[model samples]
Target: MIAEPEPGTTAEPEPEPDPEPGTVRPGGRTARVRTAVLRVAGDVLAEQGFAQLDLADVARRAGVGKTTVYRRWGSVTGLVADLLGDMAEQSLPRTETGSVLGDLRANAALVCRTLADPRQGALFRAVIAAAACDARTAEALRRFYEVRVAEWAPCVEQGVARGELPVGTDAGEVVRAVSAPLYYALLTSGVAPDAAAGERAAAAAVAAARGGVFVG
Candidate 1:
């Protein structure tokens, strides 16, 4: 592990100077640092698992300052939590393809694409393990899902407005429906889930809704 720098001392080499206000720094170092941190965090979680995650190690791997990590995220859990939130936010918004099935396929496809990345998948596994044993991690994971579900729920709401779904259907539950099977496959099968799998999950979820599986 790298030693923590003394307070008020340099941790990494400084850029020559900041750019003028409101002007883009061509080949931005700030963007590089952000990407570097995220890349390092993902790599460490994939290679070392959650229990072995430390801000110092992340800094060392990122070639960034430990102080910056601490200042930004405070702890490994916090860092991972923020990363998950960012990933959720960056994900494409639900497509309003006019039918619940169409919207659901979009949702499922995006999720499949994300979990298909080995590093992202391993990080997810580590987080899932932590969530199983640690309350903080569990809460963070739940919140991450909540954010994602909410982001996609509007499509369900649109379905309701268009009378595609029943009047009493819960939008959040509808959005989560698109994910349940994909998650099951991730946690159980070793198979690479494809767009067809997403279509199956979407069809099943919409079918369940038709059968009152999601009704209160």
Candidate 2:
């Protein structure tokens, strides 16, 4: 027979319970793996550009199995598309200030901050370059902008509802107008927009909206 522990000794602690399957908890192993892979992908895109992106290199950097990477994302374009989707999902929600101008300014400021970030700026540049040559990348890029615009368009709609802007103002167009100059500055002059530029862009959109320029 096995001997019992001493009277004064404590018994070993029981093992922790396992979580239910098909129920993904945040910060779990699966989430960690995804986080690691995406981080490595972003790093590579920022440092080497899209031209140098390879699944093998990404798997090596992520410390994940090549098979896993291939199974999860079949091709380079697929990986990039998933990355954009993740970015859209994780992006901050639109701010709802009392006034449409305030909301637009908040949106403009968010765009300016993202474009001014070093890694983000480089990543976007790489993606844009890739999009110029790859149809899949172009479509993914288009979807990303569409998501962002849809998120902010409600603010313009609210402006019209509140009588701040003319009736029938095109919400999507106004939202796009606020971001157009900022992106233009980045793509053309290679200048990341500053807070002042963001404010100017917001103000210009508001002016145009009030002038019924975006009326449908």
Q: How high a TM-score does candidate 2 get?
A: 0.86
Q: How far is candidate 2 from the true structure (C-alpha RMSD, Å)?
A: 9.3
lDDT by residue for model 2 over 129-149, one digit each (tens)?
899999999999999999999
The segments of candidate 2 whose C-alpha lies over 4 angstroms from its true place after superposition are 1-25
Candidate with maximal lDDT = 2
**What is the alpha-carbon lDDT of model 1 when measured against the actual structure?**
0.78
lDDT against the true structure, per candidate, is: 0.78, 0.87
Sequence-dependent TM-score of model 1: 0.81
Mind giving the per-residue lDDT tens digits that candidate 1 earns over 1-216?
324467798755543354464574545765566567877887888888898888987878887777666776788888888777767767677787888778888898887887787877778878888889888778888988998898888887787778777777888997787887787788787554788888888888888876767767
